[model samples]
Target: MSDYILGSHQPLAASYPLALVDLDGVAYKGHLPIEYAAESLVSARNSGLALVFVTNNASREPEDVAGQLTGLDIPTSPHEVMTAAQACARLLRSHVQPGAKVLVVGGAGLLTAVQAEGYTVVSSTDDEPDAVAQGFHPSLGWEHLAEGAYAVSRGAIHVASNLDLSLPTARGYAPGNGALVGAVQAATGVKPFSAGKPSPAMYDMALEKAGVSSALVVGDRLDTDLAGARAGGYHGLHVLTGVNSARDDILALPQERPHFIARDLRGLLETQPEVTRENEWFICNDARVRILDGALNIDSAGEPDELDIVRASCNAVWSFVDEGGEFDNTSIPHFSTL
Candidate 1:
C-alpha cells in the first residue's frame, strides 16, 4: 500500500532469470493466440529469460498444450509447460500414500498427472479412493461432482487444481474449475485445498523446477496470477489483455495488487517509468493524475503513452485508498484504449 509498484531501469528479461507465465489470457485467449503474445515471448526468450508456461487448465495433457502453443508459433515443448493438474498431483503426493487410489474429478490432464505421480486414478466413489483431486474440464457433469462430494464426505482428502470462478472461452467467460468445486463444497460443506494460483505451492514448484533464485510472475488475472506472485514473495507483471481491467488494478484488494501493469506482453521489452507523487499529483512519464472531490482526474493535454496514463491513474487511486479514502469507482477514468 506504500507504493510498492516498481519501475525498471533494466528490462525485465535482464533482471529476472525466469518468467512464470500464465497461459489463458496472457499467451492465448482460449484456442487462439492473443495479439503479439508469441513474438513478445520470443523476444523475452532471446533476451535470456527462461519462459515457463504455467496454467490452471487441467483438461489437456502437457504434450497437447505444448502442441497448441507450437501451432500458435510459440514453439514450446512439454517440459516447458506446468499445469494446475501437476500442482494438484504434487499436493496429493504429500497428503496421501504413493499408489493410493485417487478419484479424478476432472479430465485427461488431472488423470495423467496423478498417474505420473504414482496415484491410481479412479472415477467413482465405489473405488473408495484415498483422496479426491478436482480440476476444470469442459465435459464435467453432475456425476463427477457427486463422486467428489461422496468421496470427501466419506473422509477422503480433497484437493483442487484451482478455484478460478470463470474460464475464458472463444465465445465468452464460462464456468471454471472453482465453479465446479463449489458444487462439491455445497453438497458436503467441506472445502478443498487449492493447488493453483494464489496458492504458493504452484509457483514454488515452478521456481524450484526452473532452479532460479529470481523470477517474475506474469499473467492476466489479479486474484490468481498477481495474487499468487505476492503470496510467493515474487514480483508480478499484470497485462490488460485478460479478464481484469486497469480500473480493477486501481481498486484491487492489497493482496491482489500487481507490482507492475502493462497493456500487453510487449511491455516486457520496455523499461517501466516511475510513478511518483509530487504534492497532490501522481505522475508517470508525461501523464499526471489526481483525485479531487472524490473523483479521479487525468490531464488529457499531453500525448503520453496510453499505458502511462493507466499507470499514473492506478498510482493515484491506490495512494488515495491506502490513506483510508473512498471514492466512487465510476468516477475513475476508464482508459479503455489501453
Candidate 2:
C-alpha cells in the first residue's frame, strides 16, 4: 500500500463536477443524517458540484429518497437521484420487449419503478412472467424467492439490483439483496445479472444522468461504492461515518482502497492544502481528534488512564499505514488498561 498523501498538483483533482453519495450508510441511516453529512452536501452544492444520491437500497424510489433528504435539509431533486431499483427497471425495459411480463421479488418501490417503465408486473397468483427481477428490500422473503426461482427456471431472465450480501445498520450489518439472490440462485440454479454497485451498470446510468466526466463516488463501504467507482473509472472517497471503521482495514478491504479517506463528510469538506507527505490522522466521533506527523495520535487523556482504547486505536491506525502489519486483537497486550 502506498502511504503517500495526495498533493495539490496530483493529476486527479479532488474538485468534482458531480458527486454520487450512498444514502443509507453515507448520507443518513434511518431517519438521522450521519454527522456532518448534510453540511457536506450543502457545501459541495455551494461549491457548484452537482450532488446525486445514488443508493443500492431498492426499498425506496428516487422521489421518496429525495423527499427524505429534503426533509433532512439536504437539497436534492428527483432527477438528481438514481437507485438500483430504477436502474434494474431501465435495463429490463431497454433489453426486454416493451410491455413484457415481469415478476418482481422485492419491495413496493421496486414494483413501482418497474411498472413506471411500462412492464406488466406478474405476481405469484398471476401467470409466469417473461423476466424476474430482484431488488434488495427489507420485506423480501422465501415466498418471493420461490417465485423468482420458478420464474427463472421457466426461462425468465434473472435480474438482480445488486449483489451486496450485507447492508450497514445502526446495530451492525444485516442481510442484503445478495442474500435473496443467493436463495433464488440456489433454488433455480441460475445466476442473476446485477445492475448495481460492484457492477458498472448503475454507475453508467448515473453518469448519463449527471452528464459529467469529472465525478466522485463517496460512500462508507469499500465493496459496494468504492469498488463500483473503481470499476467504473471514477475517484472514490471513503468516509468513516457508518459501516466502515478503522478496524475493518485488515480483512474487508477491497482490491482498491479509496483514493481519499475522511473521518466524515466534514473532514472531506474542510479545505486544506493538499497533503505534502504521508500523514496519519486520528479519527473519532468527537472533533477533538488531532492529526500529527502523517499519523493520528490522541493526547486528551492522562497517561494513567485510557491506555487500552488508545493502544487499540494506534494499532488500527498503524495497520492502515503499514502494509505488512497484522491486526490480531489477541496479540496486542494491555488492551484493558485504557
Candidate closest to the true structure, highest TM-score: 1
Q: Write the per-residue lDDT of candidate 2 for residues 1-338, one digit (tens) a residue.
A: 23222222322224677788888778888677787888878876886777778888887877888899999989788888889988888878655886999998988778988998899998963596889889988877778788788889989998888888988776778898998799889988888888888776777777787777768788888788877887887777767777765444323454445655566776446542232212443332321222344344454554422322332344344455455544444432332421
Query: Candidate 1 — what's its lDDT?
Result: 0.88
Off by over 4 Å in 2: 1-5, 8-14, 93-95, 249-254, 271-338
Clashing pairs in model 1? none
Q: Write the per-residue lDDT of candidate 1 for residues 82-146, one digit (tens) a residue.
A: 99999999999778988999999999999999999998888789989999999998888888789
Q: Report the poorest 10 consecutive residues by lDDT, candidate 2.
A: 4-13
Clashes of 1: 0
Instruction: Compare the candidates by lDDT and give the number of the best one.
Output: 1
TM-score, each model? 0.96, 0.77
